[model samples]
Target: MYPLDEAARAIVPNLRGAIDIPNCGHWTQQEHPELVNTALLEFLKGL
Candidate 1:
């Protein structure tokens, strides 16, 4: 609902990061499923 990149960058600690899906709004997963899935997979793989 908000600008999560800036907020997450501020509060999510050093090891974590945020993604800003360009041309998308609040419903990122719905609007950009492939991009979101790719990001999620990459993040999960790192874990």
Candidate 2:
């Protein structure tokens, strides 16, 4: 939350959607690779 709080605040034009992944901490791609991959696929498909 600390590292991402500032980034979260910048939500005017550039940023689109934000996903708060659970069951994982900072290292999301490393700690939860499968979950990250699945989420990425779904998001890409939407576009």
Candidate 3:
């Protein structure tokens, strides 16, 4: 979902606080509900 220049920000161990969903596109929450939900759950748990 990131622009080409910003794509590299999706990599792991980077300072950017983003979760990279493999093979995911623009409709990430819709197309990858399980992955999104899992990430959300984990994030919420930390709060």
Candidate 4:
């Protein structure tokens, strides 16, 4: 996933890179809303 994500970042100029959410699967936002929200806010703040 990391390599695939990196490939996506390379093609998408505005992509901020990948974030790994520990102990979670496909439904990351539902399972780990706090972690997801925090990361999202941090990414947005950077931009």
Candidate 5:
């Protein structure tokens, strides 16, 4: 999916802002919950 994502972005740069939450597959949030939380918090703070 990462490679496919890259190819899609290459063809359609406008979709680069998309956030692909690969929850089921190697779930980054579950694997690294603290990291994910920190990033989320920071993003919200920015907004």
Candidate 6:
């Protein structure tokens, strides 16, 4: 659904981080709601 991660990072200068949810697709929250929510919570807590 998008460019390769490395290519995306190179194209978008402000890309800061990633949460790799293996085997998930473009709609991560819809595809893996629990995993996505957990990752989002962890990310927000760190900030």
User: Largest lDDT belongs to which candidate?
Assistant: 4
- The regions of model 5 sitting more than 4 angstroms off are 1-25
Q: Lowest summed lDDT over 10 consecutive residues: which window, candidate 4?
A: 1-10
Query: lDDT per residue, candidate 4, 1-47, as tens digits?
Result: 56579778778988767887768899999999998999989988997
* Cα error of candidate 1 at position 34, Å: 0.0
Best by TM-score: 4
The TM-score that candidate 2 achieves is 0.56
lDDT of 1: 0.80
For candidate 2, give the lDDT of residue 12: 50
Per-model TM values vs. the true structure: 0.68, 0.56, 0.61, 0.69, 0.47, 0.56
Stretches off by above 4 angstroms in model 4 are none
Please give the ranking of all candidate structures by lDDT, highest first, separated by commas: 4, 1, 6, 2, 3, 5
Q: What TM-score does candidate 6 reach? A: 0.56
lDDT of each: 0.80, 0.76, 0.74, 0.84, 0.68, 0.79
Candidate 5 local lDDT, 1-47, one digit each (tens) = 46577778888976534345554457788877886788788777877
Q: Tens digit of lDDT per residue, candidate 2, span 1-47?
A: 34675667676555546677767789999998988899899888988
Q: In terms of TM-score, which candidate is stronger, 4 or 6? A: 4
- Please state every model's RMSD to the true fold in angstroms: 3.9, 3.9, 5.8, 2.0, 5.2, 3.7
User: Candidate 1 — which residues are off by over 4 angstroms?
Assistant: 1-10
- Clashes counted in candidate 4 amount to 0
Which of 2 and 4 is the better model by TM-score? 4
How badly does each model clash, as a count of residue pairs? Answer: 0, 0, 0, 0, 0, 0
Q: Per-residue lDDT tens digits of candidate 6, residues 1-47?
A: 34466787888987666667779889998999998889888888988
Model 3, runs deviating above 4 Å:
1-16
